[model samples]
Target chain A: MNGVFAKLRTGLAAAALASTALAGPVSAQQVKEFWHYLGAGGELEGVEGMMEVAKSKIDEEFTHRVVPGGSAGLRQQVQVSLMGGVPPMAYQVSAGLELNQLAQSGRLVPLTEAWEQINGDEIFPEGLIQVISYGDEKYGLPFAMSMLGNTWYNKGIFEELGLEVPTTWEEWDEVATTLEENGYVALTSGGGSAAWTIYQFYAALFDAAGADGYWEFVGGMMPLDDPRFVEAVDLFEAHFVKYFDDEWTGGVWSDGLDRLMAGEVAMYNMGDWASGYMRQRGWTPNEEYSFFPAPSLQNVTIFQSDVIVVLKGEETDLGMKFAAAAASPEAQQAFNAAKGSIAPSNEIDPSFYDPIAKMEYDKLVSEDAIVLPNLYVLMPSGFKEDLGNAFTRFGATKDRAAFDEELARLEEMRKEMYEAGEFGTF
Target chain B: MTTLNPLAAIPFRQRDRMTYFIFLMVPAVLYVAAYIYPTIETFRLSFFEWDGFSPPEYIGLENYWELLGEPRFRNAFFNNLKWLVFYLTLPTVTGLALALLLDAELRGSVVFRTIFFIPFTITTVAVASAWRWMYKPSNGVMTQFVEALGFDAPNWLGDPSINTYSIMGAALWAWSGFTFLIYFGGLRALPTELIEAARIDGAKFWTILFKIKLPLLWPSTIVVLGIAAVDSMKIFDLVWAMTQGGPYRSSSVLAVEMYETSFVMFKLGQGAAVAFVLLVVASIVVMPYIYHMTRQVDEVKE
Candidate 1:
């Protein structure tokens, strides 16, 4: 009688195990974890909006982790997570150097298959796609972009001086002189630690160096001592630096914009974000203030984009689906609309863009447009930092000898970095 | 009274020893985990080449060798030395002067003392930002004052040649209040008869101060100098918030270099190497004070 009871209990246990196995996957929902630098402000709203648009498209439920500290903070957190062997499915990273670093570390898997599925090659600019690519594989999906190299100016200041928007370097020189003669600060950028603002000067440099020269320079092929590069540097030192505010080094990027807004300064060379700053302050775009691409870079589109990078993880397939959603037109529209940045895709309608962003979109789609990644997103982080420092020093001193020495040092540094296999193809 | 005392059976001395041991155990474990272990790890990692993400490659002193060749590191090292010298001298002297001035018996002197000490009470970052605005080239208070005095106002924080000194000026302002408080306490605690005797001997005010008061203030001096030395070595928040070791690292110091290398440049091994160098240098600077204080305590006990 005891053996009969034991057999019955064992049979019941087997039936229960079978039922549990059948119910597990159906009952449990797969959660895809994503990391982003957007926490507070419009960026948070933007990410949330993007996720809302992407929710139906992606098969799995996803949770977004707001990583504080911008790109630097995101990089540090991602490093810690990767070291712990629990990297998130995807994270927001800049398109070029930041993404390349992770890809080179073997932490990120290529999203090329996903990219092809979204018709990314057809929609995104070729240069932008390359910026997000590592070696032969695509590692990032471009989402939002800001057009660089535009000179944001006070329309009030221009009207007071009767200066039309300069369409040529010579015309800009006259306009700058006129503004200066009228006792208005002609051109300015934040120096000191905020010296990276001087990369706007590189737009002019890019114009001096044609597409080929610019490519060679950024690709670590062209030496800084090259005559063409020197000429570009000379233009930056001579023309732009001539009109730079004597006290510019004391202020930061926002201060420069503030000066422009107050009509004390005539022009500021900054990214599209300056317009957002202006709009926030109740300054009407195209009426109170307006921007135009540097006359020399009128045909060249210098852009910085935020990208979604898929890391190696258990839920990589879901991560790819999210990347696809991020790259899709609907999601891009929703994200960029809230984020105050223009969509990376050319297919996105321009009706929703602000006046300045609309101008950027038109220029981006123009036949003559030669799109290039901004210097910040083009070179390795170390080299980029060194270059910014060099420029800041040169901005203050204007000593040609010291500038040349910096150039030589940077050339050698770039060579070493390239030899160490720290770069991707231009 | 017939009472059961569990610990009484143990000798008083043994019980006392156990009590001390129990008190020290937590801190000992914490010190090893928080300080000693991490320091050892930092020293070990300094010999490897790691970029935070990849497995550390054992490079074995290559990081140090490279640092020696790097111009930026040398610049930062010298800047740190400049900070050390300035901290050791300027704050000490200015604080002594202020203490001497405030030591006088006068009305409303306490209010003046409080006013001077206010800066020290503020956070370093706040102090830095305040000073940064005052050093702004265009409309800074300093610039406006100099310009109003019929002189051309040179760029305070913009000129690389002068920026370190400019920042040091701010540091002095922030830190002198601390030293002044110490010196004031030292002055108040002094025996009045000594100074009275010096005055009765026809000694001048200068002579009395130099020959009598200054020598007696050694303990306060030591306290101020020891703190200033360590503070100088680890100076980061001020320089970082103000100039970020820029106008091309002209104001760069060892601590700033360490942070930038580790977090900004993502060269963890190289950054650790910098941190180790800082630890060694700081230890060298602080060790003598530690020994001196411990020796004083031993003598007192004797």
Candidate 2:
């Protein structure tokens, strides 16, 4: 009876092996999970496109878990998951201090080998690469880069009003006046939306402070009483706050975008993702609408990127391969096309991008483009929130005294942060 | 018929006590694990600076000190106090008034009660969304109504001066239904003879309501106030969903501040400090009520 049972077991094992062989190599394929907060609309499409592109470049199968909540939500979920020791193969994060801090905590796997495999130094710009790197190691592979210092406008409105794309602050002010005289919202956004309102400040600050001064400001070396800083605040107020109509207060960012498309607003200064949103809504770029880099004293590109951070784990090798795939020119092209962002890699074929994106791509690679990370990307955690709150209040109340008080507070905070060496090599 | 009764040797009183304790053990353990442990952990975390992932550095009372000096914190703290005061009084009064009117057995009172109760049945998020539209400055129902009367409509939500009150109004609309149900149940349980006697003695409606009915409704009031107090203290969803405690932290409360600090800012220790402050405030406000309820229970037992 024992001999018969052993023979039966051997036969079953052989049958199982034959079935596995019939199933082919596909059955044995490694499956890696990626977690991201890009759950809806263009971002979701972009992420899916990137994953599909990655699959063609790598042997592993990638599955995605759409984490709800935007960056803040993703951060909370990632922190909890990492603490619980069940982190995924990779997760999405902004490509600066957000990644650098995680790397500092030693929770992330350095993508140095993956970077070398992908020829990262040659393809990706040195500045952006350094922004996403920690010390001498890479921890994030950027997939989508958004130029925040750009203003999207309705081409038809500009044509109808016989106005030109403003390339300077004076020209911009004149254009805004023309739009307002024609009973259009001059510069529109979700007035109650704190983050976008804060971006208005960052963009204007770049325009007002100039690239070098802005760098000094971010480095905490600029004095609080700097005229450029005051001018930036004034420009932010005039564009983002004072012109904001009461009707717009109850709306969100998308609502502002909708109003702009509908010709209710003349212009919206936002990240390139606004273009992604516009494209998703069937608006053709550079036809019905167009954009220009935010009016600046000198050419500047305030950019931020979304990166895939590989976790340090058993699936680390698979994660690196996935990151490498994301960094590949083909994947970057596909992802950026869907995302309405410019490819981070210089090797990407710009012919695949729309005209506006192609222009952005050119600017991104241009040595004359004074590239800097967006304020949120440049600042550490608390500083961003503090600045955002101050801007939010100023945008709503337009109280100069309160704004000055906040500036004072921020100056103190900057000193403390600088003293503690919190500005991590940005 | 049983082989041997193990519990039979035990005294009846002790055996009953043992059964009670065994039944209580499950919930007791669960309570300790879920609520008590987290509360204690939060209190401990309040004393340390943590960024969710990094090793927590001991910060002692610095987080608390910052909260004190922070204007946003003061704004949120005051907003919470306003919520507590309004929630404790407005809803209870509105509910009582509705209950009394219904108890009078006027025509269509049952339908009125159901209509009034509808807001409570809908989720707070839905209610807040609906009210937010109504409060909108441009073409909102409230704005149109005000304009129709030949007056300017205030920016119900946009104006920092009135945003908190506007939100409180929505909360009142959603909350009064619950309080009405409680009061209605309490009123129904009251003896009819007492109210009839007051009427026979020529007591006015107001007099009868204040003197005869309201005093008897203390138990229900206590229940309502207890719920309202806690609800106001931890109010987050409606405020967050509606204004996100904005146009600028104008309508922010302790709960919203805690959420922003912990989740949005990732200042876990500061968030914990905010939470502890809220917990302390809530305890101080509710302790007297708890004691009163305890006394009420003890008196009834005696």
Candidate 3:
């Protein structure tokens, strides 16, 4: 009876081995979670679709999910979540202190090995690649990029009012005046929406200061009291107070975007994300809406990118695949197409983008193009906030002295931040 | 009853001690873990300059000193004080009025009560969104109404001069329900004979409200004031969701400031300092009331 039992066990074991051989390699029990904030049909949605594109490489071993919140609210959630030990395997962060500080401090898992494995160097431009790395290590992979100075306009309104896309500040002002005189929204710049819109000061300053000071101003090496700074602020203050409706402070950036597309507003300068927003609202680019770099910003792209950060403990094999997949040209094209933003990968097919994105992309690679980093992204945490508050105060200023005072106030804060070495490696 | 209380036959000390500890153990452990530990940790954190992730450096009183010197801190502190004063008085008065209006127990009073309580039931995020629209200068209902009435509505959420009051109005709308419910409960618990006697003595509505009812509602008033004051000290979500402590940080309160410092700015030490200051301020406002209440409880027991 013992011999018979042993034979039976042997037979069963052999059968199990045969079944395993036929079934193929079993994937690990892992799911990579992505964190971003927004609704079902925007950036987050576009990313969710990219997970499908990634499946051929990673799906056998990994699944991806997204947790969402408001933009700033989501950033806070990622920080607190990391502190709680378990964090999103990958999360979207702006390309600056939030990413750099974490990446530099080694709290974030560097993605260099993954980038190398994926041949990211060949896919992304050297300059673009350099922007996403910090302290000689890459910590984030770019998913979506937007230039902040893309002033979107409703084509129908432009046609109705006989307005051409303004190529300079003077022309922009005249257009604003024309739109307002015709009883339409002129420009959307102020409070109540995303405060980062206030960073258009950098854009306005670019036009006001010429390219050299613009570079210096944004490099965090220039004084806020620069004549260019005052000129930009004065231009900003006057334009904001006069052209913007009293409601801009109550409505956020998206509000202006919506109003612009609906033909209620002629123009509003927003990040490249506006293309995604416009598309999400079912508007066709060029036909329904058209955009250009902000007036006076010659061949400039003040870009902000949403980069995927892999947390330290979350550097599992599957996690790396997810990060690599995020930066894949295929993923970038799909995401940019859906998100109405340009793909960060230079190798991506231009045909994958909409007309507006293609136009922006054209400028991005132009010989004259100067792709300045988004000012808000470069500033330390809450520094952009300080600038926004000062801008608001400046909006309420009646005279040059008060305007100069706000500038001095911002300069003092920047000086203190500089002393504290917040600029790090500017 | 004569069945000999066998359970009670045990010595009072033993029964009381075992039961007390067994019941209190879970709560005591939880309290220590959740509240006391964090409070102590925050106090300790206040001394060190640390971003949430990085190694903390001992900065001693530097964070506190900066808090004292910072203008934003002063603004937030003053704003909190404004919230405290406005909240303690306005909500209580309006709630009392609402309670009185609904206290008549007339037809549809229950409906009226439910309607008033609805704002309190909605989440703060939703409440802020709703009120933000109403306070919107361009197309908000309030703005349109004012314009219709032949006056320009000041930017309710924009102007620093009136933004705080505009927010206070929303807080009042959302919070008055809880106050009303508490006051109503207190009125329910009052001696009906006193009100009836006043009525018989020709006490009108105003007289009954001022003389008979309000005097009897002292304890409820104290509770409302305590809750309102403490709650106002921690008003963050509404202020953050609505204005983000902005239009220029004019409407910033201590709670919003603390959150921005700690999370947004990642200045853990400074944020902790703000939290400590807020705790100290809240305790200062609530302590005397607590002492008085404790004395009152002792008197009742006596």
- The best candidate by DockQ is 1
Stretch of 10 with least lDDT, candidate 1 chain A: A22-31
Clashing pairs in 2: none
How does residue A259 of candidate 3 score in lDDT? 72
RMSD, candidate 2, Å: 9.6
Worst 10 residues of 3 chain A by lDDT: A22-31
Interface RMSD of 2: 8.0
lDDT of 3 by residue, A227-255 (tens): 77777877776655456565566555677
State the local distance difference test value for candidate 3.
Answer: 0.76
Report the CAPRI category for model 3.
incorrect
TM-scores, each model vs. reference:
0.90, 0.90, 0.88
DockQ metric for all predictions: 0.24, 0.22, 0.22
Q: A1-426, model 1: which lDDT tens digit per residue?
A: 999999989965775455333312222122377798977677788888889888978766787889887777888887766544566888898787767766777767799999999888899998898788877889999889987888999998888778899888788889999988899999987765633545756765676778788777777777777888888887787667777876677656777887888778999888888888898899888899899878788788888899998876677788888998988998899888887888989888779888877888899999988988876666765787888888877776667798788889888998898888665565
Which pairs, if any, clash in model 1?
none
**Candidate with best lDDT:** 1
**Candidate 2 on B1-302: residue-level lDDT in tens?**
76488889899999999999999999999998799867877887788887776666788999999899888899999999999999999999999989988988899998999999999999999998899779866567988999999999997877789889999889999999999999999999999999999999999988988998889998999999998988989999999888889876788999999999998777889999999999999998888889988999999999
Clashes of each: 0, 0, 1
Q: Give the Å shift of residue A402 in candidate 2.
A: 3.2
